[model samples]
Target: MKKTINWKFTLILLTVGFMTAVQYNSMKNPKERDTRDIWAVRHELAVEKQLHSELLSEIRELDKTIFTYKSLNDENTGKALTETVDKLYSQAGMTNIQGTGIIIKVKPSAESEAFGIPVTDVSPDLLTRFVNEINRFKGLILEIDGKRFTTLSSIRDINGITTVNGLNVSTPPVSMKIISPSFKDSEKLYSYLAASTIHDDFYIDNLILEVGKPERFVEIHGSPEMFENQFLKELPKGE
Candidate 1:
């Protein structure tokens, strides 16, 4: 009878051990699966964030490039660039414009009475004296009739053969344009020239005067300090 009891007890103990082992294994499987699922979600989120950061960086770079290109293509920007270039050119002593100013045109007097001499036959010295007088008033010559003047402007003989500088350009029935900074100075100059003996036989007329506008061509070269300040202050940081 004792042997029979011992056998029954052993069987019961074995059954309890087997059931505990199975239950523990089942719970562990589910916990392990949950851990793996969490890991996968975190990994996917990391990848998505990395991709988003890369896309954002690319977008920022593209914006900068587009802005730069559009600024260069704009007309106002072009004008500014041209003006900057002109300033540099002036500093280099390669420009023709001396200063900001206006252009004034003067026409010769028309005569109804014939002086028995053709207008073209008039002495070239008269024209030379007139040009000299205007220059004395600090006038910069632009044109005489169709002739264009430059930094090295000069007068030539009516025969169009000889060149003269610092003298009245010898020509008949002269038409000329002058560039000056002051309208008052230009008017005074006209008054002086008209009252002088040079225009005694000719009528003096003011044709047109053109003033400089605020808009001008400019070109900026090299990285300026202002750009450095702007760049440093506006630089983007990483995500």
Candidate 2:
């Protein structure tokens, strides 16, 4: 019992310390932007929105855990701590998810194929914008080309090839799986994505965005990489 209590307390302290470091960094290093194009500004806004949403979600989760810890008896403390840890892992994209959601397929447009026009690679900017829009509805777990999309994941172009989570996905016929909180939400997301202008955005690039119908069973794999506190060091002990 003593060991269990010590472990849980240590875990909570470590989590709090990490979050404090993140908060300090955010306060210390504010983002600066120069005169840029509309697309750049839009992308920045989207990224900010996504970060804000994630922070709020995590805050809620932590608050719930704190309440649980305060009220939990010794008999149930272990079980509650285990459940909280599992939930945190799932939210961090460390666990595969099977739930209600939809699949989206991206490929070359028929017109491009028929006209023999070379299909361009997926634009990293455009893909990021689309992800931002998808996040607006919330309750989403996304995976692209079998790579899970986590908060730390990066979608960028290296030598003209787009990569998500450091894996190449610039080619056509890319598959994206999204797991939603419920079937109803998945259906709504399908309808929303189907009507989104992102489809037109892809069409302009000779690519197609096909949003699939809602499914009760959708699989989203976990992220392969783990989050690390690369920059943070242990704080000096209090006097």
lDDT of 1 by residue, 40-130 (tens): 9998888788679768986996687557657785567767657666754543324444332233333333342234433332234544555
What are the per-model numbers of colliding residue pairs? Answer: 13, 0
Q: Give the least accurate 10-residue stretch of model 1, judged by summed lDDT.
A: 218-227
Prediction 2 global C-alpha lDDT: 0.88
What TM-score do all the candidates reach, one by one?
A: 0.34, 0.70
- Candidate 2 regions exceeding 4 Å error are 1-58, 73-76, 228-239
Model 2, 1-239: lDDT tens digits are 99999999999999999999999998888677466999999988988988898899989978988998999899999899799879878978899899999999999999999999987778899889889889777778999889888777899998889999778984888899999989999988988998888999899899999998999898887887777778989788883
Residue 132 lDDT (model 1): 60
**lDDT of candidate 2 at residue 163, scale 0 to 100:** 91
Candidate 2 to truth, TM = 0.70
lDDT of 2 at 209: 93
lDDT, each prediction: 0.49, 0.88
Q: How many backbone clashes does candidate 2 have?
A: 0
